[model samples]
Target: MARVCVVGSVNMDLVFAVETLPAPGATVLASSMSRSPGGKGGNQAVAAARAGADVVLVAAVGHDDTGAALRAHLESNNVDVGGVIALPVPSGTASIVVDAQAENVIVVAPGANGHLSLSSPRLRDLVAGCEVLLMQLEIPTDTALAAARVARDAGATVLLNASPVGADPAALAQLAEVTDVVIVNESEARHWVWPVPHLVTTLGARGAVHRSAGGETRVGAPAVEAVDTTGAGDVFAGVLAAGWAADPAHAVRRACAAGALATLVPGAGDCAPDDEAIEDALN
Candidate 1:
């Protein structure tokens, strides 16, 4: 299996299901509420593991029950948690509101995620030995970039998913310099001009487009009714990272299928499809 290292955040998601999202300064009641393990880093780690990759996640969590549960959840999903550290802070939390259309609005409290640092030798070694280093913006941008630099120097492929947009342009540009492929949603794609070797823009149900020095290619997604769009983008990025080194186009197709499948279920990490399920979707 491909070995993928993820340097990002981990959070416990508090989800509320509502008929419609609240408008600005408006109050709304949710029909139901639940909690789940999520975070761009954790979600992508689980997604890659399910897609048959050896995954290691480098992140931090609070020294609390929520953090313990989050770590256990990742372990249950087959992700190596050796690099996960517990700190004297509250674990990260994301309050998500999902509407009937599977669209969502999320607010995150960084908590311990804000304290993640890549200063440890063990963590640096972990980052330097992976086949692919996957990252997101939920954590400190400087930390993510530092990990990317270490991975890039060790001949590893770097994949950055610049989500939740709003990253410092100068820092993002520096990250792009060391990244092999940069994945983003349509909106995020327009947020910055990436200087990476490959840029992949995910188009939701329409699929994704990949551009590189060689040229550009587009792939279509399988049709499916979305139950909840949460973590679908993470699924795409993780699945893509799992197979990208072998075949870029095929990886995009698989990632598209896996992402579409993710919407059939609610929540994030638990919804990722395994290799067989993804192949079945493709067939």
Candidate 2:
């Protein structure tokens, strides 16, 4: 099994379900509202664990009840939380709206997540010890780059998800030098930060595409009735990393299946599908 480390952001997701997404400046009533644990980092970490990876998370949450609850939740799910730190700020949060068709819009407030700096020696050392390092744009760019450099130096394969967009060039270039794989969606693929040769692009209902030095392979997603589109990408990343060490080809297919299953539920992180669920979906 591969040892995976995820260093990124953690947040509480406040979600509203609606019949249709409102146009900009349009006020509409929500069908329902709920809360869940989320954040690209948190989602990927939990997803990897559920996908059967030995996972550790390096992140910071606010020193509040929400943070504590989240920590306990991840711990219960079998992710090592020793790398998670508590900072003196409000926990990060995301306000999300999902429509009847499961399309979503989100706004994030990075509170304690902003306090996670690149200076943590512990973080670098942790990355060095892992077989894989998974990261995202939810954290500071410099920190994500630093972790990648350390993990690469220690011979760990680095997988970066170019998401939540808007990454600056310098960080993107540095990451390209160290990253083994870059995962993105169609829109994100257009904005490739680094010229990484290895790439995975998720194409919604069309499935996902993986490109490498040899050629490209496309895997079809399992058909499912989507309840919420949130966290589908995260599930794909997690499943990809989890199966990568043992079987790259099968992993990609499993990843697509897991992502499809994720859409059958709402929220992220804590909602990742289990192995049994993934296998069932594939059947």
Estimated TM-score for each candidate: 0.99, 0.97
Candidate 1 global TM-score:
0.99
- Per-residue lDDT over 1-283 for candidate 1, one digit per residue giving the tens place of the 0 to 100 score: 5899999989999999999999999999999999999999999999999999999999999999999999999999999999999999999999999999999999999999899999899999999989999999999999998999999999999999998799899999889889999999998988999998999999999999999998999999999999999999999999999998888888999999999999999998688999999999999
lDDT of each: 0.94, 0.87
- The C-alpha RMSD of each candidate to the native structure, in angstroms, is 0.7, 1.2
TM-score between candidate 2 and the true structure: 0.97
Q: Which regions of candidate 1 are displaced past 4 Å?
A: none
Off by over 4 Å in 2: none
- Model 1, residue pairs in steric clash: none
* lDDT of candidate 2 over 210-283, digit per residue (tens): 89888999989988788888989998988888878787778788889999888888887666888878777777
Best by lDDT: 1
